[model samples]
Structures are given as structure tokens and as C-alpha cells.
Target: MVVKTLGKEDLWCGVVGGAALATGGGGAAMPREFFDARVDPLIEKGVKFQIVEPQDIPEDELIFVRLGVGGGIERRMQERCLRRFGVADWIREMDRVFPLPKWAEIPDEEWARVAPYRRLVELKGREPFGFMPFEIGPNVAFEIIRAAMLGKPLIDADNAGYRAVPEVSLGTLNVIHAPITPYVVATSYGDLMVFEKFLSWQRAEDLVRHIAITSGGGCSGMVSFDEDFIKKGTIYGTVSLAMKVGKAILDAREGGDDPVEAILETTGGYRLFEGKVGGTTREGYGAFTWGNIWIKGTGEYAGHTMRIWYKNENQISWIDEEPYVTCPDPFTVVDKKTGLGLSNFRPDHWPVGREVTVWGMKCADLWRTERGLRIYNPKHFGFDIKYVPIEEKVE
Candidate 1:
């Protein structure tokens, strides 16, 4: 049923609408508006995407973008920015400092001041928008800043699921276990600014007050990043999917039907666990987004609970407050309203208070064989998972 074609006309632009929903609440913040003549050319030219695999990629070509802000960091940064620089100029100033893919000039000392404020962008992946939410962790301050020293285009492709959570270690590009700098202590005063990077995610989060005061209640700077990883890991189809999920959900919702029903019909109804979010635990730290999605079911499903956790890089399941859904299983937070799922790369604040919804998880073995498997696999996201489809699971 999966058809591949570009500009093939009325061909059902699945990626188009899909890109929009991937953005979560922050989809509106995209630098460029969707459905414009500018983007049409790319769609027409045949731009193929295969999730984020280093192997399938041509070593020479590259693309990248940091999607979503860490938990509440965006809100704090926004508040601090508005207080000091005002809304109009806040985004403007951020743009000035973190211009797209261009080499920017910075004062060595000034860079130090804002180094910990933020890594400029974040990338997280999950089952959202019919594809995985490829993540870009918020790297540490100057210590691990790659793009800053080299300068890179921070592409506008963060079509992640929701938008909170900020653990830098969840990204695939990183080899070391250490997470990207999760905290940024920023200060700005009119044209004067200072920054300090912190290893602590919460401590850095707490500095919003100080930075707002320091930036004269207004802060601005081009966030720094790692240029190489951006090119290597950042997937290309963000915009394409954001716009489509809505219609997809609408159609699924229109038949007065439940998305869960649709999923069961399409995916063969693989049951992993059913419960409400609990414990406040999460997959791991420094994930583009991380939180414990507690699930305790009512009726027969009661007593048994699950921690649908993620590290922004991959998901690890916990049953009855213990880690059970370990590596390679697919875990996602679906929107109760539309029945659409967002990427795990969503910000940490996403799952908080979002009502008790179902968390669907599929394991690696579900997607191993060449022929489609009914079991859950990464490919169910519309991209290739580590394994192949299992007919037994699906059927």
C-alpha cells in the first residue's frame, strides 16, 4: 500500500501534511510558512528521505536541524526574552545570532556568557507524523559546541511531536554517554550580553530569572551548535509531514471512528500495555524530551502500570515502576483529540497534564524480516525501523 513518488501529481502528499503535525504546539513557530511556492520546487524535484540512517546516506551530502526546545526552557527563554528584548525582537535577535547555516561572528567572551544558555537547537525522534521524530540533542556549552566553532545552517525542520524535555544525550549522533549541556545561564542588557553553560538541566532552568535580569530583562544571541552532526544526522522531510497529519487524523476521526480502531485495523492491533501515566520517571536524561508516561488502567487493566519512557534517543519501557520496554521497542504519545501521535523528540513539558491517553509500543523484533511483519517495528512510523514487519503480529 505504500506508494513512492514525487511530483507524481495528486499522488497523496502524505509527507506534506505529516510534517506540520510533527511540530506539536510549536509548529506555528516555524521560520517559513508551509504550502508556498518556495517549497513546491523541492517536492517537484524528487527529494527522497529515509529517516536518519548514516549508512543509506551518501557520505558527501548532508542535512540537519535541531527540533523542539527542552522542557519549559522555551517558555522560560521566551519569558526572559520578552521581558528584556520584547517579542518582535526576541525572535529577530535569536535569528541574528543563530543565522541559518551561515558562519557568524561572536565575541569570545560573549560566546562564553551564552554558552550554557542553550545549544541553539534540539532534535528528538519518536512515532509521530507517520515517521520517527529524528532528534538533535541540546549539546553542552562551548566544550562540545561543534557548529558554533565551525558554523552551520540550523535548518528549520524541528517537526517534532510535542515541545518540552531537554536531554542532550538522547540523540543518535553522540558516541559518548555524556549528554549535551542541558542548562544555559544567559544574561542580556540591551546590546550587552553574557552567558554561562551548566551541566545541570534543572539548575540551568532555574537561571532564567538571573539571565532575564542580566540581559536587562532582555536577551539575544545566535545559539551555537555542532555543524558536522547537523549535516550527518538531521533528516530532511520535516515540512512535508507537518501539514498532512491533520487531514489524516480528520479522515480517521470523520468516520466517527476512533484512531485506536484505525491503528488496530492497519497494524493488526499489537497489545503491549494499557494504563495511565505515573511515577514522573522518564527514559533518560538530556533527551531532546524525556518524562515518565505513567499508565494505570481501570477494570482488568488496573494494578498493572507502565512507564512509557524515552531518552529522546530511544525508548525504554518500565512495567509496574520498573524498566521493561527496553531498547528497540516503539513508544509514542498519541493526541486524544485527533488520534495522531507526536514524535518522542517533543519537549519535556508535552506529556504533563495531557490527559490519560494510550501509549503504543512496538519492539525491534517486530520489524526484522524483508517481507512485512504484523508486529510493531520502526517502519510503522512510515520510515524503516531497525527490524522488518512481522505478519504474525499484524495479522
Candidate 2:
């Protein structure tokens, strides 16, 4: 079996490249606090984060998709769950309720990260062979850490291709008509819920989203025992792709080269626009962050303005109020100088004068299919605009 060990540089690559592919959502790149709190502890124990090829996985082994739903009323949800369960501290209370001898020494935060996966194992009566991220984001670190904690490697693949999507229906598994249930969800305040079956992927999305709304946020674990199903339902080598993109950007920056040029070369993407942040409008509703960014052009693109609309992830862009690029074509805004992808979560990052570059790339072949466009297109997001490939729009 061929295995690749992910070093500190590789992990940082995942953070940077994952954020770039995140399209303005998918949580921020791994923060210093996260590295200190989670990654450092594992390294001190001699645990190496490893990525194994999909073909290397044993036929008998089961793989679980790890997903987290963000954007919720955290403080309110905490109060509600705590009051309902009569516990002052959720993790401490959970230890008292569903004690695990094997996890007795695990820190509370670490235990919370793996709780959903542990619950899945208990329900299935089978330990997972490895874990795969449902998408790319900060969760890339979480998945790697979870797999290492469970003495397993993370498969070099992702369910949401190279970028993160806003809803469950956007996952590759859904595109392939894979069943999502026989899943387990673990909320922040120690609530564990299991779904033995679900009516449909759409309904499952609604249910899980509501749970996230009520619980403030939570992680869900779903398993697939069929190797064939996994192979067909996931995009392979995306983890390596993320690392490659990140390394190229980092290398260019250190060499006193143009990071934007490095990004375009690394991803075969286009420089859609270069400008200063003109303004932005964002709102949090229905457990999702929705917003738009306005960029006043600069340099060669002077006098032209660009607008991007996003529901967690960038969905569409318009140049001078005319459709330019629309989803399932992945696009992002990044700091031109640092080459780091910016997140919508930080309004300050896009202040009026912040110079940035808008980069657009052709999405994976999966998203180009009719079925893929039906769910991911601008029309699906309530925009009347039709889906157009980025290459067609730019070239």
C-alpha cells in the first residue's frame, strides 16, 4: 500500500489551498490556536497525519464521511441544551452519560471532534477503516486529526470535490444518488442523534440543517461499506491537489514572485478581476450566510466593476451588471500580495481599500454534468441566470 505522510508544510498547504477552493466559505484556514490546541498535541505523541490512496484501502474496510454544519445561534443553543439536560458543562456531562474507556484520557475538545464518528462505530458495530472529508476547508485539519486519533489514515479524496458547498444536496454522493443515512449527528452540547433512514437527500438536508440551527452547530458521520460506491461517489486526489496549490502560492511568495501569477499557473485559472473592495453586504439567515461583494476595478481593469453573489460559497459573478461567471464554476477572491484566500466571515478582510484579485477556475468534470448543473446552477440558487462554464465566459 502506498501512503503519504502529511508534514507541517502539507497541512498548511491544505489550509491555504482549501480556503482558496472554499469560494469564500468552508470555514477559515486553520488558525494558530487550532494548530496549537489540536495538531501540536498529536505531533508530540508521535502521531503522523497520513493520506492513503483510495485503492490502498482494504475491500472489507468501511469509510465514513465526516461533515460539519456551521452558522447557528451558539449561545442560545448552548443555553437551551444545557437547560434541557440539566448540565453545566456539555462534554463533562457527556462523559458521565456515555463513558468510553478508550477515550478516557482524550481532551474534551478532541473528544467532541470524534464523538460523531465514535457514535457511528457503536451503531454499526464496525470500526471505520479510515475517514474522508465531505469537503475541503478547515475541516481538512479536523478530518486528518480525527483519523489519526482513531489510528487510521484519511483517504486522499473528498465528497464535495475541491471546493466546499453550502448544502448537503451539493455533495458528489447526492449527485450519484447515494443514500446519506444510517448516519449519526453530535451537537456541540453533547446531543447525539441517529438517522436509520431518510426519505430523500433533500429531506435529509432540511432535517440536518434544522438540527444545526437548533443545536447551534454539529458534526455528522455517515458510513459506506461498499468500496465501489465510494470510488464512484468521491473525487480522488483532491487532498493532494489542495497541497499542491498551497505550496505553489507559498513558493512564489517566498521567491519574490507574483503570487497571483503563481495561483493562475498552479490552477490553470483566470484573473477575472483585480480591484479594491468597493463594499459588501452579508446576512446570516436560515443557518446559512448569504452575501454579495462589490469590487471597483484597478489597473488594467480600471473603470470596470465586478459583483459576486454567494450563499456560503461564491455562486455567481457579474461584470458591469452582466453575468460573467456562474456556478458550478469555482471562483474566489484572494489577497493579491499574500496569495491567501479570504473568507466572508471576516468583513474586515474586505475593507474599502484592500487590494485583491478574483480568480476563476474550471470546476471538476463532475459539476459540469447535466445532473450536477441542475442542482448547482444559478437557477438552482433562485437566480434566473443560466449556468455557463468559466472557460466559455473567459476564453
Query: What would the TM-scores of all predictions be?
Result: 0.41, 0.89
Best by lDDT: 2
* Model 2 stretches with alpha carbons more than 4 Å out: 32-37, 72-112, 217-225
In candidate 1, how many Å is residue 313 off? Answer: 9.4
RMSD of each: 12.8, 4.6
Candidate 1: global Cα-lDDT? Answer: 0.35
Model 2 alpha-carbon miss at residue 294, Å: 0.7
For model 1, how does the per-residue alpha-carbon lDDT over 1-395 read when each residue is reduced to its tens digit? 13222231211223323322222222212112333333456446544322232223333333332222332224444443443344345645666765534543333434433433333333122111112233311111111122222332123233122121222222332321123332233333223322345554333333443443333332232222333444333334332333233345456777776654444344333445544444364332221234445666645567887665443333444556644433333334455455554444444334544533443333222122232232222333243334422232223
TM-score of 2: 0.89
Worst 10 residues of 2 by lDDT: 79-88
Clashing pairs in model 2, backbone N/Cα/C closer than 3 A: none
Clashes of 1: 80
Model 2 per-residue lDDT tens digits across residues 1-395: 89888887688777777777778888887675666676777888999889998877877678888765765344555454443443336546656776646644533444445677778788778887788888876557667877887788999988777788888788777777888777777665555778888887767778888887765444444555456667787889888888888888889889999888987888788999999999999876666878899999999989999999988888889999999998888889999898888888777778888899999888778777777777678887889997778888988
Global lDDT of each model? Answer: 0.35, 0.78
